[model samples]
Structure formats: C-alpha cells, structure tokens
Target: MTALVIIPTYDEAANLAWIVERVLAAQPQLHVLVADDGSPDGTGAIADALAAADDRVHVLHRVSKQGLGSAYRAGFAWGLERGYDTLLEMDADGSHRPEDLAQILAASATGADLVLGSRWVPGGGVVNWPWHRRLISRGGTLYARLLLGLDVKDATGGFRAFRRETLERLPLDQVASQGYCFQIDMTRRVAAAGMDVVEVPITFVERERGESKMSGAIVREALWRVTVWGAARLVPRRLRKGPRPEPESLASRPGA
Candidate 1:
C-alpha cells in the first residue's frame, strides 16, 4: 500500500530532521510528510531542504501555529487527495520512536482498519518520564477508556496508523480536539464505526528537546468533550448503532 507518515511540528527544529531520516530509513515504502506550523527556528526551511533532497520527503507549511488536530486534518486531506492508501500520525518531538513504525505497519496489514502503537500494552513501555507525567498519562488513558466505553488500553496515544477508507469515513470535520485528545477522539470514532482496531506494543521516549504542547485548557477540553460524547452514547444498547466493547475485556488486556 502507498503509505505516508504525517508529523505535526511547531518549533521542533532540533528533532525534525533526525526523526524524518530515521522514519525514512525504517521502511522503504513509507513516505514522510512534515507539517510545520511556521516554526521560527527554521523548521520549515529544514523541511523544505529535506523535501528537496529526497523524493520521499514532503512538506506542508501552514501560515501559523494551528492546533495539532488542524495540522493533522490538513495533512490527511493532503494525503487523501494524492491517493495514499495508508496514513499514519506521529509527533515530531521524538516521543514516538521511528523504528516502531514497522510493527505498526505490520498490524495494519493484518486487515485492521486502525493500528495503535500503545505504551500500555504488553512489551510496551515509557522511558525518562517523571512519576507525575506517568500518572497523568495512565490516568488520562483510563479516564478516556472508561468514559467512552473503549476497550483499548492506550486510546490517547498519538502513534497510530489508519487505513485510507477509515480516515475518509471518519467525521474529521467534527473533530475539534486540539491536543493529544485528538487521538482519543479519533479512536472513539473508529470504534463507533465498527472498524477493526488493533493495538501493538511501543516504547515511548520522552522528548529530550523542544517544548511540550500540553496545557490545562487542552486537558479540560478533552474531559468536557469525552464526558458529553460518553453521555450521548450511554442512552441504550439498541439506540447506539455499533456494539460497545465489553468493559470486562479490560481484565485480559496486557497492561490494563
């Protein structure tokens, strides 16, 4: 399948080039698309240089720093219009390892509509993260799962791959999540659509450079939206179009 990796960036000059090169090296079929949000640190120029050097590399320069969701939406549109069969989303901050793309792609090839690189699955782990950060990640993931009736362990993970049909069918226009919550929103939608979803083990490394984009407001938006969505879906079993994943499955999940 024709594949593209969409990496959203904002002032990620230190990490972009290395990440793009490693991703390109990891899989020959995978193409890299860098969506730079007018990084003042010359990130856009670096992206342009890479694109000019390698035919596999592409760049998208937005006018300003839009939210992560918008950047991804724009990137998806770009890939879809160009007829890419598979699309992937990852962060430019080095938190997501490029090598894991192999396993993610393998899972996608197994007829799964969406493949999630999960830190909360067996063989998956995190490195160099503080206790509080760990707590927040684990807690936020559990919160999203419980609220949305999601069976997966890492709904909020940004390292994910989606089939073109799945992305095209998802209601992307309605997805307004700004932060990592976008991952959760998309995951929930994929499940709601009754699409095949798979989770694979991935080692998440905390970014050694660049600033984190997390904020209190983003967290609040996630919580608010998830609550509303969950409430609407909880009306009744017959009312919901798709079958909800059984909550009891959490007991068997590797890292649940």
Candidate 2:
C-alpha cells in the first residue's frame, strides 16, 4: 500500500530540512508532501530545494497563511487525485517522531481504517514539556472527550494515518476547524462515520527549533468549537444531522 505523509508548515525553516530527511529515512517508499503557506522566512524556498533533490519529496505552496484544516484538506485532495492508498498527517516541527511512522502504517495495514499516535495511551509519553503544558494538553483532550463522547483517548493528537477510503467518506469539504481543534473535528467525523480507528503509542517531543503556533487564540478556538459541537449534538436530530449531506456515513450518530 502506497502512503503519503503531509507536513504542514509556516516559517518552519529551522526544522524543515531535518524533518524531511528523517521522514524519508524512516521508510524508503514513503512519499512526503510539504504544504507551506508562503512563509516569509524562506521555508518555501527550502522546500523547493528538497523537492528538487528527491523525487519522493513534493511541495504545495499556498499563497498565504491558511489554517491547518485547509492545508490538510488541500494535501489530502492532492494525494487522492494521484491515487495514494493511505495518507498521513505530521507536524513540521520535531514533535512528531518520524520513526513512529512505521508503527502507524503497520496498524493501518492490520485493518485499522485510522491510526492515531496518541501520547496519552499506555506506553505513550512526551519529552521536555513542563507540567502546565502537559496539563493543558491532557486537560483539553479530557474536556473534549467529556463533551463530545468520543471513545478515543487523545482526541487532540495530530499524528494520524488514514486509509484513502475513510477520507473520501468523511465530510472533508465541510470541516471548518483550523487549529488543534481540527484534530477533534476529524476525530469526531471518523467516529461519526463508524470507521475502525486505533491508537498507537508515540513520544511527542517539544520542538527544539522554531516557535510554537499554539497560543491563546488557538486554545480558545478549541474550547469554543468543542463546546458548540457538544451543545449542537444535544439538540433534536430532526433539526440537526437529519438534513446534512448525502453519501456520508451516519451510523455512529446519536440515535442513528
């Protein structure tokens, strides 16, 4: 099964080259597509250089800064058009270990429709993060699980793999969340579609280079979006999910 890993970036030049090399080294057949949003720090130029050197490396340059949701949506559509059987998401920073890509793919091959590299699962942990940061991440995930009723442990995780069929069946065009909330958006969609989702242990490390995009705005977005989704689900189905798009799976919906 062919796989394509999508790495989204904005001013990630410091870590871009290193991350790309590590990803390619992890699996010889693994193809990488760097989706960059016109970073002023010459990140796009660096990506172009990498693509020029390696046939397996590709680049998608957006004219301006778009949210992670849109970047992944574009990358997914690109991979689907070219007929990749499996697609994956990884951050540009070093947080997502390239070595773990093997485990994620192995899980997918063993019949998992989606594989999440969860830091909260048994054998999973983080490196170099202080207590409060860990609390924020774990807390946010916990709050989301409580509100959304998702069975997954790390609902806010970004490291994930998906079979192409799963993405096609999901309402990709309708996803609106951008920040960390994008993870929750797709997680809910996967559960809503009743796909076989699995979680694997992965060590998430704090980025040694580049600034973290996580901020008050991003945190607020996750809180607000998750809260709104939870409240909407509490409403009667006749006024909510009943009128949505067609060909979309709703087997996991409430009272479906």
Candidate 3:
C-alpha cells in the first residue's frame, strides 16, 4: 500500500535530518512530508535540502506557526491528493521511534482504520522523563478518557496512522486543538465516526535536542475544547446527524 508520513516541525533543526533519514531508511517505499511552520532557525531550508536529495521526500513551508492542527490538515491534503492509502503522523523529535512506523502500517493493513503508537500499553513505557512530566501525561490522558468516554490508552499521543478514507471523513477544518489537545480531538472524531481504532505499544523517549513545544496554553486549550465538544454531543439526534461532505470534494474547496 502507498503510505505517507507527515512530520510537523518548528525550530527542530537538530532533530529534523536524523528523523527523516531514519524513517526513510526503515521504510524505503514510504513518502515523507515535512510540514515546517517557517522556523526562524532555517528548518525550512534544511527540509528543502533533504527533499532535493530524496525523491520520496516533500516539503510544505507554511507562512508562520499556524498551529499543529493546521500543519497536519495541510499535510493530509497533500497526501490525499497523491492518492496515498495510509497517512501517518509523528514528531520530528526523536521521541517517536522511526522503527515503529512499520508496525503501525502493518496494523492499518490488518484492519484498523486508525492506529495509535501508545506509551501506556503493556510493552510501552517512557524513558528519561521526570516524575512531574509523567504525571502530567498520564493524568491528562486519564482525564481525557473519562471526559470523552474513549477507551484509547494514549489519547494524546502524536504518533498515529490513519486510513486515507477515515481522515477524509473527518471534518479537518473544524479540528480546533493545536497542541496535545489536537491529538485527543482527532481521536475523538475518529471514534465518533465509528472507525476501528487500535493502539500499538511503543517506547517514547524524551527529546535530546530542542525544547518541548508543550505549555500551559496547550493544556488549557485541550481542556476547554474537549469540554465544549463533549457538551455539544448531548444535543438532539436530528441536530447532530447532519449530512457530511466527501473528502475529495472538501479538499477542492478554497483554503481546505
């Protein structure tokens, strides 16, 4: 199956090249799309250089740091236009192992419409994380599960794979979360649409270079969005079951 992996970046110069190289080396046939948010550190230029050297690599240079949701939306559009069967998302930082790409793709092939690289599963765990960070991640995920009524083990995980059709069914522009919330919001949409979602165990390592993009703003955004969306689901069935547009048709629209 044709696969595309989207890596969103902002000021990730130190980790960009190695991550891309490792992904390409592991999955030779997989296409890599780097969606850079115009980093002041010249990450866009570095992505261009790599794309120049590799036919399977492509780059999307946004005007500025729009947000994680916007970058992934654009990347998904690009991948869909090329008729890719599977679309994957991951961090540019080495925290997400490139070795797991194959397993995620394999899971998708087996029947899962969405596959999450999970850290809370039996074989999965975190490395080099302090107690506070671990608590934040575990607590945040647990809170999301309770609030959203989702059975997912890692709702906030950025490492995931999607069947092209499943992403196509999602209301991409309506996805409002920009940080960790973005991941949770998308998973909620996937489950809401009755798609088969699965989680694969993976080791999540802390990044060696560059600072984390997570902040208080991200956490707050997630909390607010989930609360609002969850409440909306309580509306009458007639109001909620509105007709949705096709993915291809949506993509052709302006600013999709």
Candidate 1: tens digits of C-alpha lDDT, residues 88-115: 9999988999889999998888889999
Cα-based lDDT for every prediction: 0.90, 0.93, 0.91
Displacement of the residue 226 alpha carbon in candidate 1, Å: 0.9
Worst 10 residues of 1 by lDDT: 237-246
Tell me the spans in candidate 3 whose CA falls farther than 4 Å from its real position: 234-256
Clashing pairs in 2: none
**Ten-residue region with minimum lDDT total, candidate 3:** 229-238
lDDT of 1 at 79: 99
Candidate 3 residue-wise lDDT, 1-256, digit = tens: 8999999999999999999999998889999999999999989999999999999999999999988988999999999999999999999999999988888889999989899999999999999988987887888788778878889889998999999989899989787678888889889889989999999999999999999998888888887887877667656676777866656777788899
lDDT for each residue of candidate 2 in 6-75, tens digit (9 for 90 to 100): 9999999999999999999889899999999999999999999999999999999999999898999999
The TM-score, computed over Cα atoms with residue i paired to residue i, of candidate 3 is 0.90
lDDT of 1 at 204: 96
Choose 2 or 3, whichever is better by lDDT.
2
The candidate scoring highest on lDDT is 2
The whole-model C-alpha lDDT of candidate 1 against the native structure comes to 0.90
